[model samples]
Target: MTHRYLKNVVSLELDKDKCTGCGKCTEVCPHNVFIIENGLAEIIDRDRCMECGACANNCPFEAVTVEPGVGCAAAIIKGWLTGSEPSCDCSGGDSSSCC
Candidate 1:
């Protein structure tokens, strides 16, 4: 099955101008989030990203950026278990806190 988290919530950003078509993001991404096409890196599946920061770290041209460890995965799993909307409530002293 294709794993997808909250739609349009991932922080992944790609600067196509800086990509240079190196294909490093495609190689390092665990979720196949990137694809090199026409000499530019593209974010093929942003929701599949687990916020692991691998693509950003491996991009030699500094084309990719993402806020890793933003509790997206945890929030999605929590939502699945509770049948609620995915949310990352990092505030302390709360039952719904995913941090």
Candidate 2:
């Protein structure tokens, strides 16, 4: 009954190997998803992330990646109830019809 890859799993995964420690991802992230730990952007306060694609877009090194945005179960449920787009943006728009 669980929607795989359609659930709210907002967590920052830092690829330490790729992280150049540019600090760009940390700076633009409105949720403060990254931090400088040993000169690398460590995953800190991941729950605070809103998954707005800021981290992914801002990540110049392509080190950090996350399924950002709307981890709220209620919202996903509501979207389903109203035939709206699922939680993920794979549809390429804000509504289900766009999918």
Candidate 3:
């Protein structure tokens, strides 16, 4: 699947100190953004992230933190053309605010 969202737009922070190498993020990410290497979760495809916040939500140790939002480039362009700022409602703090 292809998305129009800008690459590297979403803020995804991984804290190695907090990460337990549980691999939950690997299991939840639909875009294969995370991989377990040597018992640690590493981001291998950050550009493919869709800001779904599934990894952040599923992290038991709160190792993954991301600011989820709609990074659609087309929407941003449309907003610029329409004289409005495009914003996503997803806060990425929890699953309830996910897009």
Candidate 4:
């Protein structure tokens, strides 16, 4: 079997206009990906983000979204090998992993 190198890249996008200052996204994130400045969620650490999707799922106003998941290389590779579609936290209605 040929092995593929895993690259877990997570995108952190916040819709400032849609945010309602609920602070839910910042609360659910385990990797400390966001910070509140002027009552808005800011992307502080994109590299550290695990892609857990907690923020997107918890956001009440749907202001935040990600291709959510843990961003773990090994985990994603395993999922791919097993023929299961990888999951993301900000997947909207795709599926739930940690969010």
In lDDT terms, which candidate is top? Answer: 3
The C-alpha lDDT values of all candidates are: 0.79, 0.71, 0.80, 0.71
lDDT of 3 by residue, 43-97 (tens): 9877788777899999999999997755666556656777776554334354654
lDDT of 1 by residue, 1-99 (tens): 755567888888998778799898888898888888888888887788888889888888888898876456777786789897766654546765545
Model 1 ranges off by over 4 Å: 70-99
Clashes of 2: 3
> Model 4 has how many clashing residue pairs?
5
Backbone clashes in model 1: 0
Q: Tens-digit lDDT track for model 4 on 7-71?
A: 44657688999987777777888767778889877877676666667888888888998876554
How much lDDT does candidate 2 score? 0.71
**Once model 4 is optimally superposed onto the true structure by TM-score, how far is the C-alpha of residue 2 displaced, in angstroms?**
32
Candidate 2 Cα outliers beyond 4 Å, as residue runs: 1-9, 71-78, 81-84, 87-99
Give residue 8's lDDT in candidate 1 (0 to 100). 82
Model 4 quality (TM-score) = 0.64
What residue pairs clash in candidate 1, if any at all? none
With a 3 Å backbone cut-off (N, CA, C), the pairs that clash in candidate 3 are none
TM-score of each: 0.68, 0.60, 0.65, 0.64
Give the Cα error of residue 31 in candidate 2, in Å: 2.2
Candidate order by TM-score, decreasing, is 1, 3, 4, 2
lDDT of 1: 0.79
